[model samples]
Target chain A: MLEHVVNGLVLGGTYALVAMGLTIQYGIARIMNLSFGDTIIAACFATYVLFSVFAINPILALLIVGPTGYVFNLLIYRFIMKPLVARAPDEGALEVDSILVTFGLLFVIQGVLLVMFGGGYTSYSFLNSPVSMLGTVVAGNRLVALVLSLTFGAVLVGVLYRTRWGMILRAVATAPQSAPLFGIDTNRAARTAFAVGGALAATGGGVVSMFQTFTATAGVVFTMKALIVVILGGKGSVPGAIVAGLLLGLVETFVAAYIDPGLTLAAVYTVFLVLLLVRPNGLFGKA
Target chain B: MTMKTSHAFLLAAAVLALLAAAPLLIPDYWTGVLLGMTGYVTLATAWAMFSGPTRYVSLATVAFFGVGAYTVAVLNETLPYPLVLLCAGGIGMVMALIVGFSTLRLAGVYFVIFTFGLAELVRQTVSWWEVNITYTMGRYVFLPFEGRHIYWQLLALAAATFLISWGIGRSRIGLALKALGDDETVAAHAGVDVTRIKLLLFVISSTIITLVGAIQAPRWTYIEPSIVFNPTVSFMTLIMALLGGAMRLWGPLVGAIPLFLLFEWLSVSFPDHFSIILGLLFILIVFVMPEGVLAKIETLRKGSPK
Candidate 1:
């Protein structure tokens, strides 16, 4: 049980990092990037390829992955999102169109990755030996992921809270039209927030590369999880994402450990159903 | 009926008659593919019938399709195919009504998630059900009909679905659905029975979709939970409908045939990476022709500076 919880925390922390990126985009853009996972998965595959071929340091993989994610989202915003925004005159239409566009985006990314990576699973192992942690045996790479994720979470939260750019982002998220009136370039801020979302995707990809073997389809599953986390945590709240992320991590791990591991997604769906019925606004989402 | 409605009816009947007879004229290989293509057309048309009018991006077609497939797998041996198909469709209706009522009251996004969750939920339940009870993980079905017989059966189903869709597109409920899709609040204020219409459409669409799956299951010979509940199947139907023109009566067939041909060609050309080509195509469709190809052509005909 202790081991499961410890492992779950690390998993949750990584998911939280991913969810925070989604949260920022949703906060500002009010659109969920379902293809967000594509970037993360790309980062994973790119890191694995780089390590295998270039003989690069595994620990420094994020340096490559992070910028790739950033550029990927920038492309998305430029090519896909901007056209969608131009076409949609209303929020309802925007919501539906964006969802469909992202859904298509999801498949496109999955297909491209499948072409690049095939169906084979690739993984990176940092320290294969198990480390004893508070009487629970855990893998060292998992521990590294946990530590890195927690640090990333702190730095992310800090950046959002303490930075001028973060404040500008918040203002634009709250009031896109009025932000420009207040001398804030809402479009630039929104684009920057998307880049931040991409960085989170890269961090998530690195975490997965460090701890688990992944295929092209692996990131699709994360999109579902991260979307659920964002919704359950509240759309725009980083703190809410962390709380919900940890909660979901515990929920998934404990359920998978105690029950059949295959039913983890079913359990998450059940949680989503309950959340929709009980609290659509989410735990920390503003009205 | 108006001239336009009558014209649509005649066109549908002609297409149905031709399809109903063409199995003999075409080669078995092409016949088999066309039969399967009709199955997708049925799924896509019915899906668009429900979703396009409501503007609800439903992900529950997988749930209904899987349920229909599995229901037939477990019960088809004891029951006649027709009765089994009915039961399967009835089950789909029940599931749709349950899910639709519970989730449709919320926002549109919630509906999307609920449908998505329902698909995953149904898939898991089917897997668990097979593991615990079925003992036979892969159910080998003894379908009484041969390929051509099955082809005709699927054709009838496809035609029936198209006819129903045509009728609904002209009906008062269809108008209400289209209105609701544009703006729910306004539709409600305009005295549209938004919930009831949406629910009814949900049931109608699920029934046709489920029947298609149940009917198509026999063609594959072996039924498994994983194959039956695959989300890709649903995505293809959804994408086809969107690619052709979700609101147009000809959308499903127009989209299904060409895309199926394209998919076959791609599979043969680059079997391993067809998914990539498909994904790129889907993205291209969304970007270049959001209203679908038919819409694009119509615009070209009317709006182009010739």
Candidate 2:
């Protein structure tokens, strides 16, 4: 039971980290990025290449890959997504256009990854030593992943709640139309939020790569998990994501350990369905 | 009905009849390709029937389709073919009612994701059952179906889908659905029974989609949860319908044929790059013609310099 709890925390930490990226993009940028998981997978592969081929530590790789993700996402916002935003007649239209466009982006990124990495799973030895904790053993890599994710999550929360930049973002997210009245550049906030989300995704990927096996095509599964976490936690609530992500990880781990491993996906769906029925706007979502 | 509408229907009937006789005239290889085309035409048309008017993009086409196929696979040996088909439709209807009633209340992105999750749930459940209870992951479908027989059935399904779509387009429910799509709040205020209309169309659309899978299942000699409940089916169906201009009656047909042909060629010529190109095409379509090729053409014709 203790082992499962530790495993769940590690898994959930990564989930929370990735979902934070997704929630930021959706809430602030108002772009439901279907390609977000593929971006994460790209970061994983980049870290893999750095560690395996170049003999660089995955932790060190984060410094390179995270900023790369930010820059890449910034370019995507400027070139691909900006056009759709400009032409959209309203929020509804923007949402629809963004979904379709990012869906296409999902395929594009997946296809490129498939070409580069082949359709096979890849993992590398990082800090795989076993560490004892609470009379149970966990992998050193996973402990590091958990720590990295928790630290990042803390920094993100601190930035969002304690900083002026964070206030501007929150204001835009709270009221896009009214933010401009308060002298906020809604466009810049959106772009920055989107890029920060990308950086989080890359950071999450680097953390996950330290402990987890991943494939180029496995991006969709992560995308689905993050999406579920975001919805469960309430769309834009940071604390909600952390709590829900940990809870989901526990549920999945317990299900796999005690019940049937195959039922984990079913259990997730059951929770999602029941939650949606009970609270359509999510736990922390505004009506 | 107006004279123009009646005339259009008559012309459609004529074309479908000619296409029905196509297997006899064409080579075996071409018959196979046409079979694929007719199948997609049926699926895409059924997808657009509800999504076009309601703007609720359902990614559960494969969930219904897979249930229909699985129904036939499990019952074909014991039941007559027609009985199995009927069972498939019955199962499809129940599934649609359950899914539609449960998830249709959520709007926009929530609806889309919920439907997707529901489909994934169904797929995973079926997979678990097959693995643990049946001790088998796949089943062979031993039906006495020649390619031509499946082709003709698909053609018939395509024709029926088109007719039903056309009929619904002129019906009162269609206008209500259109209103709901435009703005659900206003539609409800205007006294449209929003839930009932959406549910009715959803059932009709899903049942037909289910039948498409049942009719086409025999073509695949082996059936499994992953094979039948592939998410790509849902995405492809949505893309095809949208590419053809879902709102237009003939839009799906126009989009299905050329895109089908392009996919066939792409898969054969650039097998490794197939997905890459498919992705690029999706981006291109959304960028250049978000309203679809048919709408783009219409705009160009009207906007031509005098």
Candidate 3:
């Protein structure tokens, strides 16, 4: 039971990281950044290539991929999101448009990956190593991943609360019309949010790939799981996502271990529905 | 004669004529593609009936389609074909009503997410059931139908879709849906029973989709959880609705047929990157023509006064 609990915490850490990225983007940008999953997939592939070609250490590969993801997010915002942002605020709901556009981007990325990498699953050897944790054997890579997720999450909370940019970001998220009056360049703030969000997502993906094999189509599952975490945590609430992710991770782990693996997803979805029914605005969300 | 009524009839007749004759002219492979496209068109039209006027994108349509398929599959093994189709549609309508009642309080993105989460739940349940249960709850049972019967069944479904779309387009409820889509707050102020209207549209749309799924199952003679609950179906329907022009009577059918043909051609020519190319095309369409091809043509025609 303790082993399962540890495993759940480690898994939850990864989910929390991904969910934080999603929540941040949704909060500040008002765009779901559905392609956030693609960033993770791209980062995984990048890490894989670096490790295979340059014989780089896994930690070093993560450092390279994280920044690459940031740049990629910036590019997406500049090209795809910028033009749409300037349009009439009420012309159409941005959420639907974002879903359509980002889903299209997902398809494009997945297709490209399939063609370049083929459909087979790939894994790194170093990730397979295990470590002893208080007599409970834990995967070494997962341990590293948990630490990184928790550390990054703490840093993000500090940044959001302490920094001036974070203050402007919150202002912009609350009222885009009022933000400009306060001299906040809402566009710039949104771009920065997207960049940070993408980096976090990429970091989580890089860490997760250390423990699991993934293919081109793997992004869909991650995207779905992240969305669930975001909703369960309360939309736009970073702290809520952290708690929700851990809870969900524990639930999924227990379900997968005891019940049928097929039933585990169903159980997670059930919890999501129940949460929505009980608290429509999410656990920590502003109703 | 009212202009809207005349225009709707003309559009319906044109669509009917096209669908009726399409199989005879197209190749066998293309016929199969067309069948799939018809399903998309049917689903898109149903989606539009709810979303076009209300501006709420219900992801639960996929769940309805899945339920409809499963219902037909399960029933056809024991019951008559016609009974199976009716039961499938009835089941879909019930599910839609339940979902609509539950989530109608939420609006905009929240609604979308709610429906999406619900659909995911349905999908997970279906997956679990398929894995654990010994007896098949959602497997396709073949009804003995030949070429002409299949063609006629498709035509009938298309005709029903056209008539229903026309009715919705002409009705006050349809106008309410449109008003809701334009601005929910204003629509409510204008005396529209927002909840009832949304629930009614949701039930109507799901019923049509379930009908389509029911007939489609027998035509394919096989069904599975993945194929029935596929997000691709939702995406394809969405593309068709947007491409043809949402809220327009003939838009879905027009968009679906051509898009399916394009997909078939691309898949045949470049099987390796077909999905990628299709994705790019969708992006290009959004960038260049947000209103859609049909809407663009309409704009051009009006501007030239031809």
TM-score for chain A in each prediction: 0.95, 0.98, 0.95
The digit string of per-residue lDDT tens for model 2 on B1-306 reads 256866876887898888888889999999999998988888899989888878777778999989989888888889999999999999999988977776787776876776765666787898899899989888888899999999999888888888888788778877887788889999999999998888898999999999999998998889988889876677778789889998888898899999899888988999888777877788778889888889999899999997
Minimum summed lDDT over a 10-residue window in model 1 chain B is located at B112-121
**lDDT per residue, candidate 2, A99-204, as tens digits?**
8778778878888998899978899999899999899999999999999999999999999999999999999988899999999999999999999999999999
Superposed by TM-score, candidate 2 places the C-alpha of residue A14 at a distance from the truth, in angstroms, of: 0.9
Instruction: Give candidate 3's TM-score.
Output: 0.92
Q: After superposition, how far is residue A133 of candidate 3 from its true place, in Å?
A: 2.8
Each candidate: RMSD to true structure?
A: 2.3, 1.7, 2.8
Error of 1 at B45 (Å): 0.7
lDDT of 1: 0.82
TM of each candidate vs. truth: 0.94, 0.97, 0.92
Per-residue lDDT over A1-287 for candidate 3, one digit per residue giving the tens place of the 0 to 100 score: 87888889989998999889999888888886666777788778877888888998878888888888888888988898877776626535677677777877888888898898997898887766778887798888888878988998999888887999778877876787899998888889989888888988888888877777888877766777788888888777889999999998999899988887777767776787687679877788787
- Top DockQ prediction, candidate number: 2
The segments of candidate 3 whose C-alpha lies over 4 angstroms from its true place after superposition are B1-34, B59-61, B115-121, B135-140, B301-306
Model 1: residue B127 alpha-carbon error in angstroms: 2.9
Q: Lowest lDDT 10-mer window, candidate 1 chain A?
A: A29-38
Model 1 alpha-carbon drift over 4 Å, by segment: B1-11, B116-121
What C-alpha lDDT, on a 0 to 100 scale, does residue A196 get in candidate 1?
A: 84
